[model samples]
Target: MNKNLRQTDQPLRQILTKPEVSSRMTKWAVELAEHDIGYRSRTAIKAQALADFLVEGASLAMTGQDSPPSGERSGEPWILFVDGASSKEGSGAGLLLISPTGEELTYALRFDFPASNTEAGLADSPPDGYNRGQSQERSQLVVLQVRGEYEAKEDVMKKYLAKVREVIALFDIFEIERVSISQNKRADALSKLASSSFAHLSKEVLVEVVKQKSIDQVQVLAIDSSATWMTSLMNFLNSGVLPGDKTEAYRLQFRAAKYAYAGGTLYRRSYLSPWLKCMTPEEGDYVLREVHEGLCAAHVGSRVLAKKCLLLGYYWPSVFQDAAALVQKCRACQVHAPLCHQPARKMVPIHSPWPFAQWGIDLLDPFPRAPGRYEYLEVAIDYFTKWMEAEPLATISGRQFRISSGET
Candidate 1:
């Protein structure tokens, strides 16, 4: 019996001495000790309490415990931050739409022309959702915050204010609040970034924010079929039929050869020249305004303005007349007209009969002093022969002139 007990004890001792076996037994002993002390139950209870606290905190945050007072909470107002920046490069407007839940949507718009800060601000129209076929009730309360006080004192700003009022009428509740520049820095930064040459915007964000319309998307003007000037040309291009009258028929035939229809637009062809764009009276006027004083205009003269219109491949019967009238009526051109350098009187030619007979003399002084204290030059020129004679003199004496000219 003692030998059998010793054999079992020997096997147990060997198992305890091995590293892997000893580590496994030590882990089980620690787990058993913890279970006996009710540590697992305490840990589970603490975890469940932590989870409840997290769920309660999330619920309170979603319900907005720190929301506005009940009196002002009838309609939750969305905060709108707007700013405009004007610089030599360009003008831009920025707007920030901040939801009640703290989500923000930013937009930056670049103007076609350089504008003043107030004008730039005025250029910003309400977003499509606010302005599009939606009823006033559908429009949410908006709190507009700007950095500067909005005063429509100026005549131009008055028009802008009128537009702003129109936009304001769309909302059921709207309030304009003036904030400090420091508080509106984000909108200001967006405007400045838009005015800069390069924009640091992600492609995905720009795809959602920027709205670009293609040229083909714009509606073209409908030309009247009974229009007097264009009716004959349109008929000739559409159908190769001329009037029965000899004079009208011959005229139509000659003009029809020069005109052709391409993509629904009438174009006049010329020898060794690209087709000229045919425009109606209203279209001609618009072209003149655009080329003469539009965004990239230098406010050129009437003749150059007319030439520019033609060079741009546009043509009309009264193009020169329209361009001249437009330039004459331009307020900016009238106010900033440059001074004319033309002489008041006509220049008359001076005649000389002989070379030596018509000599003109003049004196030049205050030159560097020479060895003989000469500081003046006497210049004589024969007007007829175009010969000149110059001599440095110490003093203006009649004897020196006689001696220099070889006169006794």
Candidate 2:
């Protein structure tokens, strides 16, 4: 259809088709290079019947679709196909909405930032546009986490899932199923088009470039600073105030003996050591991250890591457990750690094939300076035969031992 639309008049074609033409015509000819076509004059109609046939055939050949229906339209639900693509060129997604009348509308969407493949048709409300033409009782959503079927791993997508859930809650009936690539060609083509570096297209395809995640609008959260774990202890230490409950006050008094406030920081008294600065879980997490993988840190084991923090004058109740959890979650530690090998069953012993089949050599020193100026004795033993031979040497050297029991 694009070729048919770009088909030009005789004079214009002559200019564009010429071997030597203007720069503009040369560019047009290059764009139309794949289309090797020439115009032919339409013959004069012989009769009314023949003329009607030619006109109708020409119209059908030009547009390849019948004129819109005059009355009621098709009532089939418009099926939608979606696919995602990611490459070095860019990350993108595409949607292909097929009308009940077999008309296809393809969308090419480009993402501005790097992330796992997202629903190309998701951010765009493709269903809302077809409200006038399709069923309205319920909407089916098929997520084409396609290509890799990527899970929503990124925080942006995780947050986006909440919004998607809220919208999906309104649907009465919905169904989703994995579809083969053959059935999703249109959307896949559009996805590739958006993700590739092809700057020129035969037909003008307007790509919707999403500059940022739609769900990333800033949100303000109110956090209570005075309600933390140490808040009560700090209040009691700063001022002589206690909670209204006698049991709670008694417990606070018992725990407070071990905690000392100094330099505007809470410290816990350590046995045979200086006071350890007590840390909240949040601060403890930062301490753990830095100390575990920080400069000069060798990614030590959990027990050692916790001990290091304790030795550094920091205290947290879950320090040991947190260190263990951090080590488990550490990507480098998991990927590059040494492998463990354990025997599947009890050990077994084996006997040698024959006497002197294998030989062992050993060195012994100092025999009061032998005739060859050798101080060490090199001994050979046969595993099966218990045969032994010895030679004296003074200096260590790298050479094959000549066994007295077997072929050298």
Candidate number with greatest lDDT? 2
Candidate 2 wrongly placed segments (more than 4 Å): 1-223, 338-408
List, residue by residue over 176-281, the lDDT tens digit for candidate 2.
4456777777677777788886465336566877887767757789987556677788888988678999999999988888898877788888789988888888
Q: Write the per-residue lDDT of candidate 1 for residues 1-408, one digit (tens) a residue.
A: 122213232344444434467776666555443332211111234888889999999999977967865534544566777777788877776778765556788878776565687666665655433321211111111122121343446765566556556676686666565566777887777777776643565443331222431211366799755574666787777876677899998888887787888777888787777889898889899888888778998999989999898888988888888888898999999999998898999999889987678888888887999999998888888999879988888888898887766631
Model 1: CA > 4 A from native: 1-228, 271-273, 343-408
TM-scores, each model vs. reference: 0.32, 0.31
lDDT scores in order: 0.67, 0.69
Candidate 2: 10-residue stretch with minimal lDDT? 133-142
Evaluate candidate 1 by giving its C-alpha RMSD to the native, one decimal: 25.2
| lDDT at 48, model 1 | 80
Score candidate 2 by TM-score against the native.
0.31
